[model samples]
Target: MKKEFMKNSLYVMIIICVIGFIIIFSSGAIGKSMQYNYLQKYENAVPSNQLERYLNDITSNFRTAGQVISTLGGFGILLCGYAHYKEL
Candidate 1:
């Protein structure tokens, strides 16, 4: 039962990521709001502090995720080819 719960949570995470990826991929308002919010929070704190650094780290993770989308997209294409090749 614990394994099943973990599987469901993972599925939910993947779906959420896909939705976030789509929204961010389009360069939409969600991305804008997130950026703005981060900027505001960073500015409210003291300059050259840990909070600012942490926010930068979070944004970098988002950028890394964009890179992953491309990697996954290519892998998905390769999977399609393999499926087709096996069908013959």
Candidate 2:
């Protein structure tokens, strides 16, 4: 049961990683800004409007949260696999 749960967790993490990649790449323009992340703030300063700022802030927060959850999911899968491995 633990083995099966970890296996499913790995697959879910992989799918989330793919979705994150899509968000990080699917902007309309090569340099278009959709998220005003702390790192992104200085880089994507061209679109300095209220709407863009709001969009950036919101997306940045959500994306960052998504990334954190994805990372946790990955770690969880790895730890579970390692535990199962040790039991073998």
Candidate 3:
């Protein structure tokens, strides 16, 4: 039934939100740790080596992507819920 589908959708969305939170937090922590490690090693110098630059760029991109996904997923969930509610 539509109600069951809606409930299932909500449940899935809840799980997705939790996953998003984990992704955001873990990515952020990893990024910060990488930055700190670089600073400690280089005495506040920017990443001069190719490997360091690549790692920093990848981590930064992942963190940004995780945050954006989390936000968009949450909004999508809200919209889905609203749409389902109106249907009911």
Better of 1 and 2 by lDDT: 2
lDDT of 1 by residue, 1-88 (tens): 6556545654555555575566446544445556567668768664555554655566666666765765565555555555546655
Query: In each prediction, how many residue pairs overlap at the backbone (N, C-alpha, C within less than 3 A)?
Result: 0, 1, 0
**TM-scores of all predicted structures:** 0.42, 0.50, 0.62
The model with the greater TM-score, 2 or 3, is 3
* Model 3 segments more than 4 A misplaced: 28-48
lDDT value for model 1: 0.57
Scored against the true structure, residue 24 in model 2 reaches a CA lDDT of: 48
lDDT of 3 by residue, 1-88 (tens): 8778777887787777777778767875777677777677877656457546756686878777777777776887897799787986
Candidate 2, which segments miss by more than 4 Å at Cα?
Answer: 1-48
Candidate with maximal lDDT: 3
**lDDT value for model 2:** 0.60
Report residue 21 deviation for candidate 2 (angstroms).
Answer: 7.3
Error of 1 at 33 (Å): 5.1
